[model samples]
Target: MRILTKFMLGLMLVLAVACSRTPTRAPSAGPGANPQLGDSRPHSWTSGSPYGQAVHGIDISRWQGNIDWNRVRGSGISFAFIKSTEGGDHVDPNFRRYWYEAAQARIPRGAYHYYYFCRSGFEQAQWFIRSVPREVGSMPPVIDLEWTNSKTCPRRPSPAEVKREASVFMDIVGRHYGQRPIIYTTVDFYRDNRLGDMRAEFWLRSVADHPRVRYPGQRWAFWQYTGTGIVPGIQGDVDLNAFAGSRSDWVRWLNTRLTR
Candidate 1:
């Protein structure tokens, strides 16, 4: 309980600071790939780091504010996943801007929805479908599942129930997008929820170490290596991610796996 509280408080502090530091004017061109900004510690985790030759990317939300997409692309970020909606009604204010800007900058982008435990899965899926447009060349949609920690709707259902809800949500989203939606989850939630058994791609979050060391034999399409990353275009820290293969492998996966 103490640790959770501290984590929540630390996250709140970071969000406050990040929001306050948002840029007001157009962003300027700056450094591209800065190796010093990432986790360069010599270890297995660092070996598979996003800083390696693989295709790198980032995930953003309203907290990121206005971004210079061109600068981000120049910074070796080949793709992006932008938060589009949450629950059944909350649409990210920056989703449209990010979507448009990403397209203009030729960044392969996808939309993600933050799953709400309190809300019905079908309703949330409908909300996401309405919020995000179906476009060619876009990466598969993502469903972010994790603890809500909400007082108003703090319901942690049984494992069976959680799996059922996820199925319904993924099914609906897949039908709408014409692509299998990826699941974005924390290590604890993935283990506790039996997410590996689910027949969907995964985007894992492992900040302290590589997913290979943390998840151990689990395959992931994307690895969110760090939350506090310093990219050129972003004002504050951004979440950095890496594809699971080489540059050619990434392009092939994007071409063959993604649905129009």
Candidate 2:
């Protein structure tokens, strides 16, 4: 019986390997490039590795101080999501500088707000709206929902409450920016909030494995794949992200979905 079982397992493994090697579609111009970014290549981490053909991008806050946007643009970075605000009052000191510099370098840039569980979502949304200017060619706003583990504001609301608040924030921001906002969440937060049902696009955080492997059936507009990414022009580790499609798709999204 044991010998037979082993033989069957080996056969299944062989079949799986054979199936994996089966040809699918022709290589994209930027095969594995982020479909949304319109590049058909894999990300910096996955290119030439086991995971190939994804476009690459990065996210930054004040922690990555004094970035040289010109060098970053030259580093094959397709886009950036800059941290704009948090809670109801705090704005990242570098938000203005990063936003302007990224534009000057002609890098497509967007702003994200870090949600504070302790505050009302409306208050936070107002803060974000006041801080981030509605500009042409800017990607839709992103609401980053996660556990801060902070001592002062550590309230974990019920899933219903989380959803309600998130909806309120997204709706207001969406109206202001004239684009449907993207929701960025950690795996735990997503599961806790039951975010699968939300209508907005998602930006999922998964570092150890691909979003497909970890997230299963969930569709994400952006994948925040790593927080320890080393990029030129940035002094230290930075968070990296990938759009869901190719560069052309990215352009289409900008044209059709990103404006009033």
Candidate 3:
């Protein structure tokens, strides 16, 4: 019996190895070119290697400090998500000016709407649409829905209600932006709302580890990796994020979304 069990385990290990696949890779450097993580300049600021290549970006709210675009210019901030409006009545006072500054800095930028569980989907959608203009170079809008029982008028909507309202909001934003919007949520909030049932790409917040444990078998386009990432570009501590796959994946993503 022991011999048979060992044989079975070995076979399973072999099968698992055979079935596994790798993330897609970027093109190799051209004849005279040097890659950022290549020969002359290996990827900086890494101790133990990351699970995937580091493609850094940040998400900001008005609580952050006054940002200097020039200081952040070469800090490798590839993209940003600036908070626009939240819960219908509470708008981020600095959103408009900061968003404009980010755009002026020639950085790719997107906007987000903070979802209110008690509010109507159309109401939130309209607020986001009104706050953000439909510009060609801007990235698609994002819907941020995380639970907070401490909210002044917190009404914990049922999972079904969460899905319905989020869909309506996404559809309205999608029509205006001409692309499907990304959904941002935390592990607990998503599981509580059962947001996995919603058909939108994800930008998940998992500062400790990858979402494999929190959201098993789910796909996320971006991962907010650290709440305390210190980059020279932005003042104060900014939440740092990683693009889901290799550098090649970003090339493909932008090619379809922003053709520059």
Best by TM-score: 1
Report, for every candidate in turn, its global Cα lDDT versus the true structure: 0.76, 0.74, 0.69
Give per-residue CA lDDT, model 1, range 161-221, as digits (tens): 8889888999999998899899999988988887778889899998777787778888998
Clashes found in each candidate (C-alpha, N, C closer than 3 A): 0, 29, 0
Which candidate has the top score in lDDT?
Answer: 1
Tell me how far the alpha carbon of residue 154 in candidate 2 is from the true structure, in angstroms, after superposition: 1.0
In order of lDDT, best first, we have: 1, 2, 3
Lowest lDDT 10-mer window, candidate 1?
Answer: 24-33
lDDT of 2 by residue, 191-240 (tens): 77778999988888976667777677899888886676667788867887
lDDT of 3 at 136: 62
Q: Cα lDDT for residue 167, model 2?
A: 89
Q: Stretches of candidate 1 above 4 Å error?
A: 1-48
Q: TM-scores of the models, in the given order?
A: 0.82, 0.80, 0.78
Ranking of all candidate structures by their TM-score, best first: 1, 2, 3
Let me know the TM-score candidate 1 reaches against the reference structure. 0.82
